[model samples]
Target: MPSGPSFLKKFTSLILSFGPGIFAIGYTIGTGSVTSMIVAGSTHGMQLLWVLLLSCLFSGILIYVYGNYTLLTGETALFAFKRHLKWGRVMAILIIIGIAIGQWNSLMGIMGISSNIIYEIFAIYFPGISSFKYEAVITIALVLTAVFYALLLVGRYTFFEKILVVFVTIMGVSFLISLFMVYPLPEDVIKGLVPSIPQVKGGRMLVAAFVGTTMAAATFLSRPLFVKGKGWTINNLKEQKKDAIVAAILVFVISGAIMAVATGALFYEGKPVTQVLDMVNTLEPVAGKFALTLFFFGTLSAGLSSIFPILLIVPILIADYQSGQLDTNSKQFKRITAFACLFALIVPIFGSNPVEMQILSQIFNVFVLPLVILGILLLINKKSIVQVHKTHFLLNIGLGLALLFACIISYNGVKALIDYF
Candidate 1:
């Protein structure tokens, strides 16, 4: 073992090497994290806080499992699926479709919510700036879209990873600062740690919704793809572990802080938070209107930063299903990116209910959760790839539990949708 100073020097370099997973965590903690946590804080007032805690633990385990496999095998999860079990290719395709639907809903919803937040910020700041609201949103979106394409053109993983890390750090600090300013009660916060149901009639559904949002199907599917993009290998095992742990902790902090802020401002006041804008507005009385503006900017950054990688992941996933691996330079990758962007542009134009759309898309996305997880687990644990590093029995059992929980959620989700229809 190295001495303390030497270890610190090496550790710093290892941390720098672990970028893609950090960005993948950013993608996971975007709209889903914001919307669901906002809903939980307003509706249940931290009573369902255990959902985030439990989901974070489970999500960490899943990310570690997926990231470890990619690091060991040097192949993305989709390719592993095709190579190990040819018949399981359909499940891989389903994972991509599920991811595409989820990403489509999230990308559009984030844009809409962030746009609303910006509009509110201008109104609060300038107070008379009515005309620029729409233009401002369009301008911001175009700027972000252009930056995304520019990064894609460069085609270097390091550049994309650095941009994502910078954005993630900024967004994370902004929210943490907001939470500190709010100064929530420690006793009530502690009470949130207990796993109790809320008092409302529809509280259980909200609890499940909270769980669904945190343990998002798309977030799960995207982990391996993101790891592959980083070009990790067996030589980087230490780096992979560090990256997974850091990424998971970062996600938990940002998501949990958002919940804390919402609960601090709205929960005790008996206010409702049905939309992201509502959460932003609720912050004004407690943290001042300018704080709300800051929150909006932070939220906007969080949402906008995630759109590119999510788009990038989809086409690569689709391409991997057709071929055993993804060629970033291939026509399929470009076409899929275009298709994803088209969906992003069109999804919100229909003017559907954002919450309802989130619920529907998540429901459809959850259907393939079992298949996707199973295939990934199987491929990763295979002798050819894993060799002596096969998955442990305990890990397999835990994965089984995750799959079971996902299936139960999917069943309830489908039943709810069917009854509604």
Candidate 2:
């Protein structure tokens, strides 16, 4: 029995403590993840599930390490890179360019897929709408983009966190329910958890894409920003670690559920899924209309959740490079964010194949992983920057292995991109 003011204070503290991690989950489990997981399961069944698990596992480690670095140094990733090591500025520039291109491609795909799904839903419910017009689709995409930017423009970090929590809840619960409707076999899931790559053609490329997208370089780079925004420090390291673990677990569970639903509903069927709409059509017969609708909205929410962060990432990167504060109220910040959000419109307005663009963005994402990993490894181990929080030998070893894995994936990603072009 505490006083009202005291109880409210406690509650606010609790919410703030978990806010960064929840934001991470919201940012991580977006359209790219939903698309990747569903495609993997639909095309290859649960054979690649281990890749999701391992990617999340590695992502969790790297995320924690990066957060820890920021807590100890009071510096964001780009600043740390700039201040600590030689060639850091060049690496930062490369990272910014890579992430900008990848995010631009993803922004187009997200808006395109979300608008398409909405248009289809409208056509289904409203018989008067005879055809799915590109005009309507583009209009919806523009509206969605405007709404996302408006929210970011007005909202602070707390508000953004609350919105993400709502989105993550809606998307997570909907996907989980849909998964239950067509529950995958436990034995198949168990087999999927075992560490083994499929022998199928393009399996290596698929694995690389999965790893690249899940353990994305942007996610790691963004971690420090979130941590610093939350005002976390060495004293809050334990809480930061807990937050990272929770975010990682959420990524695994939500991603696994998406794959499970796809595996149970689409695998072994002769049908091929080329887009999100194809998923809905295939799932309608197997999981019924209710589940299909849930999945559709769930996917839409995922797309929207992802857009929020993509809008802010460029601004954050710029802020970090300039050694400036992450003040949403600043004119420069708003301008950069608005431009990034609006720039996505070009693809939907002009691109012929949104799905191909999305896939290409994911491949581009793979090329950046090794660079980010190497940067973090070099910075974190340096006693000059990290101080007493210098990475322990075991953690360094783990990161070293991750760097090696990222390098291999980068090679495969490059080869895949060449093949695609």
Candidate 3:
């Protein structure tokens, strides 16, 4: 048997090996997933939990595939697309544009919601703030944005991963505890595990949002980048698969816990949750102050965790597009990150409807899914690029089914947007 110190070293190495997956968990399970899951459970009950499971499973497969492709080719997703296939450059540009728009919208929404939650917490303690004001909320959001930017700008990739692991852990634990407090009915929860759609209005849209957020384009785009950033190679394929599994499981647990809490505390009582903050009021009456506070902290952590990756994505995408190394210290990288973070402020500062913006961002993400899936399919099958690492028969089938799933969700997402407009 190993000595205590040796055991500790091994444990530390194992945890460190999980960096890419931990980063993925942090990137996902953010405001978008939290909001979507809560809305689904609060309004539609546990009927949509199966969608979350399906999405996470699909996302896991894609994450592994992307990471494996990067390891084999030493190319990030964008560079692979741009340099490998026909019309690859055009596809890369479209992906960059689509992801940029979706991420920017999400960043604004996350900041807005996080600020409101913080302000509400402050009001509870002080009992002196008479009314909530937009200006005050915006100011809080700017501060949060500044803090997020500083953390990303000053930290190296490992620092970023370590911080995110901490945030994701806090958020995951908080939500898990909150879920236990609710104690959802076993049968209802089990029913959610069985695949069946609810007959509620906007049910399809909710399904789309759940899938979109869980299997987001940004998640896939960032997976290879994380793999490459961690200096993973073809020899790390097994580790990459393990990491993907960990991330997928984390996504399901965190998302499922939030949904269960919402279902048991709100849906069982027939309460409607139209906005993210609406849960604060509803959860308090159902699960008490402690649960409410825990939920808020979880959401705040999620928002911060999400914003870190959202800010890095644009810079990373630009680097991939230019076939350049991702140098965090580079002036271009810092400038791009800053500009993206600052530009997102426009929504929270000037827009009157942040909840709508958040929902729209998720819906827009679905529209981008089919294109990304198609690109991944095309790139992974290219014999010249993937070579011996080319996808096998079963893997291709899985990718095909995932592509089909993306197409169906994309169609529903578009229909929902049109109906709303």
> Which candidate number maximizes lDDT?
3
The TM-score ranking, best first, is: 3, 2, 1
lDDT of 2 at 249: 92
Candidate 1: which stretches are off by over 4 Å? 1-17, 125-128, 131-143, 196-205, 324-326, 347-363, 419-421
lDDT of each: 0.67, 0.81, 0.82
lDDT of 2: 0.81
lDDT of 3 by residue, 1-421 (tens): 6599899799667666676888778777888788887888888888887888889888888888888888888888888788877888898898889888888888888777777777787777876663656666778888887888888778488888888877887898899999889957888888888987666677767777788788888888888878877887888888888888888988998999999988989999998788756877788998998998898899889888888888888888888788735557678888888898787687668844656677778887887788788898898887887777658888788889999999988888888777777
Model 1 Cα lDDT, one tens digit per residue, 66-94: 77876776666676776688676666777
The residue-level lDDT of candidate 1 at 277 comes to 52
Q: List the residue pairs that clash in candidate 2.
A: none
Q: Report lDDT (Cα) of residue 111, candidate 1.
A: 58
The 10-residue segment with the lowest total lDDT in model 2: 351-360
* TM-scores for all predictions: 0.86, 0.93, 0.93
The window of 10 residues in a row where model 3 has the poorest summed lDDT is 127-136
Q: lDDT (0-100) at residue 39 of candidate 2?
A: 78
